[model samples]
Target: MVFVALLGTGTAVAGQVRGPAVVPLPPQPALPQLPWLPPLPPVPSISVQALPPFDVEPLDLDLESIGDSAQEAVLQSLQALGTLRESASVSVLGSLQDGFAFRFSQQQPPRDRTEARAEALYRSARESIDRGRYENAIQELDRLIDLPGTSRVDAALYWKSYTQAKLGQRAEALTTLADLEKRFANSRWLKDAKALEVEIRQASGQAVSPDSQNDEELKLLALRGLIQSDPDRAVPMIERLLDGNSSVKVQENALFVLSQSQSARALEIIAKTARGAVNPDVQLRAIRYLGAIGGPENRQVLDEVYRGSNDAALKRAILRAFMTGGDRARLLALAKSETSPELRAQAIQQLGVLHATTELADLYRNESSAEMKKRVLQAMLVGGDADRLIELAKSEKDVELRRAAIQNLGLMAAGRTGEALKQLYSSDASADIRREVINALFVQQNAGVLVDAARAEKDPAMKKEIVAKLSLLRSKEASDYLLELLK
Candidate 1:
């Protein structure tokens, strides 16, 4: 007798379908199965062979097999990933046979290789010049000039000419200068090129007369050269130009040339011109030159002009000259004794420029006018005398003057002024003074201190003012303090 059984779906195991487990039924009493089972004609000796386990792996679709639509979808997904990650790694290849030809690479901008190379060569040339390697620099510059469309061509030509001149190749340098002039008519480098041409001509013993040049700038260059080569001759010509109806620029250049001379004649001419021997403008220039020359004699010359002159503008020029000459004693004398308020104020300002804090403090003590004292305070501030300013803020009896000192203190460096302001704020009970202190701290952006003051402050009005200031600030401390207030 045979028994038949039905099978249900099987389990998958390691890429192979497995048959379900079979169970044997308990042996039935013999009769019923034999009659019907003759049909189960001998489930004859059946033989089964288990097949080899099938191998499995992830599918790799060929690029050729991927459709255009599918490719676009994949590329878009990669682009989205790149955007989310803020990266440039995403790329799409056209085909496997094309061997990693990226479509995205075509969108990338090409680098300015020519510009980069030109810049490198130009820099190398400059470095070589600094090291006194003229020949090497010339080689690099030549290479740079050969590059097409280089913006530095004009600069290269100028430096090359300069290098050629340094090497005593005067004829070659002139040729290069001529080429630069022809190629770039409106180039800014032409000015320096002309100056260099004058220098080279002078070095070669060629004459360069100031009168020959039409351009004032070129004439100035020529005059400078003449001064160096023949000062006696140059001095007479300069004197003629100054005394003649030459342009003011020409006269100034002449004065500058004369100032460079150490001869007694030059000094006499400068002194004579300084004492109003010329127009007011030239007189002012002369005064400045004397001050710039700055010696016992020069100072004497300035003093002579100051004592002899009544023009307020002339006196002010003298005062500035004193500052330029670093003659603090002269400035102090004027600040103390000058009766003209405008002149006195000018003197005080000059002293401040000299940072003569001691002299300023003394002037403040002797000053009877509140206005003059206020000027003294301003001068002290300009001199960066924070210690004096702090003293004035603390002890000054005049409210306006005290407030002025506090405001100036705010303009100073915070490290020194911040603590001083905090101390003043705590000690002073006057709301106006405290408000000035708060404004000073605000200018310093000392939000941490403002927050502390707000918490400790009893007046609702002042607290609200501090909070309002904090609202305009973007600092983390201000924001955090505001958040705490919200809580």
Candidate 2:
């Protein structure tokens, strides 16, 4: 066998014998076939699922019905809380449970006839007195005094005595005063009655007793009464009191009498004491007198004292005196040129009371001191200078000054308040400024605008601030927005 073993083991043509006949590899097991999955449909750029149509049901609500229901509910709740009381059904006992309620009760008994007559007569007497009808006043006083069970009988008697004295009925006036003293010893008009008695006796050329002079209360009472009826006689005594012979109380009382008198002599004495009294107490009372008796003469005296005295406190008093006298020109001059900051500030405030808006604005524009500028802002607010305040809110450069202006703007009812606050909030990045803006908006009771601003805000801290402000609002819209935020 020619080794032709059928190209057996190794092929003879290739090489002698291959290392070994290559053993055929066994067939691999086939993989299980996966079910075909369609390619995921190309994702649409927009939602593929059909969206619900944009629609809103128009509200055809009956406002009347809703209002009625709301009102009914409120009434029911009030009833439950005991806030709804049937006034017509309230008995006296029930009304008295709330003691003050009895005063307003409609079931109150009608006024007694005698009491009504007394009140009518009293009113007539007052009107007659006001009209200088002393005879008519005396007639009404007599009728009122005779009305039985009238509480104003003593009051009527007192006025009758006054009317009698005014008519020069000395004996009749003395008799009336004596009856008032004997019958109504605890009357509120007792002191006045006694004073009138002393006045009657003095006018009648009767020797006044030491009891009237020794009793200080009686003395002051007598002096006040005499000043009203006999100013000529009272003037000398007033001068004596101002001369420091009497107690401080007596001097003060004398100053009061002078304040009421129209006598030029009295005014001269008052001005003298106010100008240069050794006793500061007397000077102070005299200064107050000039302020109370405000006129050109008093103003002149106040001005003189203000210029000559080195007392800062007294200078302040002069400013007040000018205020009381309505001396706007003097106040304007003081506010402009006074060296004392306190006095200047005080004058500015008085000018505000006088509504010196133009002068106040001028001072605000020209003022340099921060404290003084603060005072100007206050004065402008008091004077209702809204335009000036708005101007300051926009143009002021000092931070504190601006803040003060803005704060005062909150106090005012300026037409530009909302606009000014919005502008400040948008332009000023300061947290404090923004806070003030929010507070001002809150104070103005602006809910809708505030809510819109809050919704549009982007800054986290500022947005938080806006929400904080809105949270304080009582509006339904604000409440709804807050509920949404809670989610």
Candidate 3:
């Protein structure tokens, strides 16, 4: 079967061809298109202009201070594996609140006393909170929170919420809209607050939806509005929808929208949803959610699911989750252990797409099953291991796997992958697999081999099909073979 590579940019995305590339069935599945998410209230946009403007002065961070153990960990974590990992990390880093305050005082009357004084004050306020110092903590937090949209906003909200909740003003805090809501109702966060209020109630075993919003439409509309207004707030609502009486649509929308909310809170809820989802749709959506909000935690959840799941589709979905999470190790491990040879092969193919070589290379080299190892080689090509893929096709045992590997060797039009296809042209094996090799060899642009195969072929039908294919990818070789056949 001819292997179809769904090349994105230039990466292979699928598997081993049997003979003729197995054409996919027609009829694309349709689902309901999602409604537009409600607009989120604007987040507190801190002006970078407030900070000292950049100069030629290089920004020096004391990377050494983080300790030696972190160095190796950081490197592995920051692997340049050409996955969307770098982009995902960039997205995550872009979202962190600027919690740090570079307290610059030109009038540093005493350098020694400044840190100590601030430390003392910070400590005193923190300790006061422990000792029923709500007012003191509030006072200190006020100054900290006021420093032009500081990272302490979450803390500020917490303190404000806590003080109000503690002082028997729980209803008010519950009903309270953030200042962002009052000042900028059009912003993303306002919608989040409305959604969050319902979620908070649900988490507390209080009624989650408004008394009037008993209908699914009303609840869904409210949720859609939430992610638009306040992703932070909407996240809780989405989680609650997952857990509550909401339909799968509401839950899916919440999950989908929260994935974009891109806050720690959103990530936290998505993790919980992935772990706790009973509905497969909910669980699968959870995978996409984790991918959208990728991290070690998200990776761990997918890995756990893959390890625990027996369903092939779910396993495939979980494999997809790992790709999104950028957990190569977990993905390869799952691939190796998958009971379904198809899933295992798919995992290997995906690694090829990722251009990850070593993860499956050695494991595949030692694979005992001919059919299985072939699957690995197919996977490797998809993953972008052109050089190794070429080598494996040359050295591989298990004739079936070797032939399968040969077919994909030229995945990236790696002209080199086809060299093996040259040798395979003469092999006396299944005509189907051999016919497949004809197409795979096209990567190396070997028209002559295909021409010879077509003319010298013993199977009339297989020869006809190969001739048709060889002509389709390019006409010269097949036409040459056709001319030779006519003689």
Candidate 4:
């Protein structure tokens, strides 16, 4: 039966193997069949219509048709946007006024009316005296003396006396000098007062010979008179004094007298003394005199002395003379070819004083030595060559040289320098370079750029450094940034 069942079912029963009999199973319940359902209807065939392409036209927004309030709002929004853009640009580029406008204002406290009047009177009196308008000077001096609490009273009195003496009113001058002595016993003008008294008394027929006088000051006065009276005679006397073992004061006075003379002999004597023919002290003085009395001849003398002498001190003096004589060509030649770095640097410095910006830029380009380049950079700075400095700061490959250029840019006033520093801070990746830029901006008091940089900086330490710099600033931009930080 189990075999018949297995054949009918086409299955093998567990435990029905040949060695074991199958246990009789309990009666199984009949299987229930599920109800049959019809097939789903064919899916509906829907077609999508292809529409023609529509052109998107711009809206014709007629602002005139809008309500007044709406139009006003739009205008305000545009203006605000414009202002924001302009402010952003200004922060980055710095203001035109900062660069072009006069930055300096009168910081001196306003003088009170009384003080002002006194000063005006004193100044006018001195100017009048200088112009040989003794009467006008006397008038101004009297007014100054009459002013209450005038500090220039002593000065006015001394000048009034001098003016009187110049005007040949010797008696009136002596009386004025006496008044000065009585009023200000411990005054600095007392020495001048005594000298004036002697001068006035001498003019009053008490003629004292300059040669007999032991006073160096009196001798100098007499020498001045002699030079004015007879320059030819004074030149020989000055040469004798310079050549002799006279005191340096006497020699310097003689040199000064010689400088005032336009005579050829005077020039020759000055040239000789400047050539170290005299004492070292006198030679140095003569070199200075040559600079003060600048001319083609004086410059030639200076050049000859510079080449002939190996003395560093004298060469340096000649360099100064070259500047004073306005011999830029000579200075440039020395700055370019001088073997002594010290003297070359000195020549470059003198060029700076002469505001030789073009020459300095040329020198910087041709220079190979780092130290010499730095000196040239300094000279450029002194010459106010901001454009060149900006160029170097941007393109110089030497890290230290670039840093130097950046540092010099900081010392300059705001405007282009501030803009260049902002750009450097934005583009440079070197932490050290960026740090230098930050320092430069701080030096320029350019808080606007500093604030902008701080906003854009990602490094925490760098940002902190920028913030620290901001804290020291007193600008509106810096204050606003700090307030924003608090919020």
TM-scores, one per candidate: 0.55, 0.53, 0.47, 0.56
Clashes of 4: 0
Rate residue 291 of model 4 by lDDT: 80
Q: Which stretches of candidate 4 lie over 4 Å from their true place?
A: 1-216
Error of 2 at 120 (Å): 45
With candidate 4 superimposed using the best TM-score fit, by how many Å does residue 392's alpha carbon deviate from the native?
1.0
Residue pairs whose backbone atoms clash in candidate 2: none
Using lDDT as the measure, which candidate wins?
A: 4
| lDDT by residue (tens digit), candidate 4, 1-487 | 0000001114566785466667999999998998889763232211101100000111112343455444334333322322222234322212221112111112112233354456557656755754567799899899889887666688788888877877789999999988999998976567657766776787788876463223544555666778878998877877776765443445666688778888888888998999875555468779987887888888988989999988665787788777767789999999998998768877987676577788888888898998788777766665567888899989999988888788667667666578888999999989888988887776667899999999999999999888877876679999899999999
Task: Estimate, for each residue in 44-159, the C-alpha lDDT of model 2 and write its tens digit.
Answer: 12110111110111111222334433422322222221211212222321222212110111111234334434545675686586466899999888877877767778878877
Candidate 2 to truth, TM: 0.53
The top-ranked prediction according to TM-score is 4
Tell me the spans in candidate 3 whose CA falls farther than 4 Å from its real position.
1-233, 308-312, 337-343, 410-416, 423-474, 477-487
Q: How much lDDT does each candidate structure score?
A: 0.67, 0.63, 0.52, 0.68
Decoy 1 TM-score against native: 0.55
Query: What local lDDT does model 4 show for residue 256?
Result: 81
Candidate 1 local lDDT, 6-93, one digit each (tens): 1123667787778898898899976655444433111111000110000011112222345544533433332232222222211111
**Residues 197-217 of candidate 3: C-alpha lDDT, one tens digit per residue:** 554455466655452223544
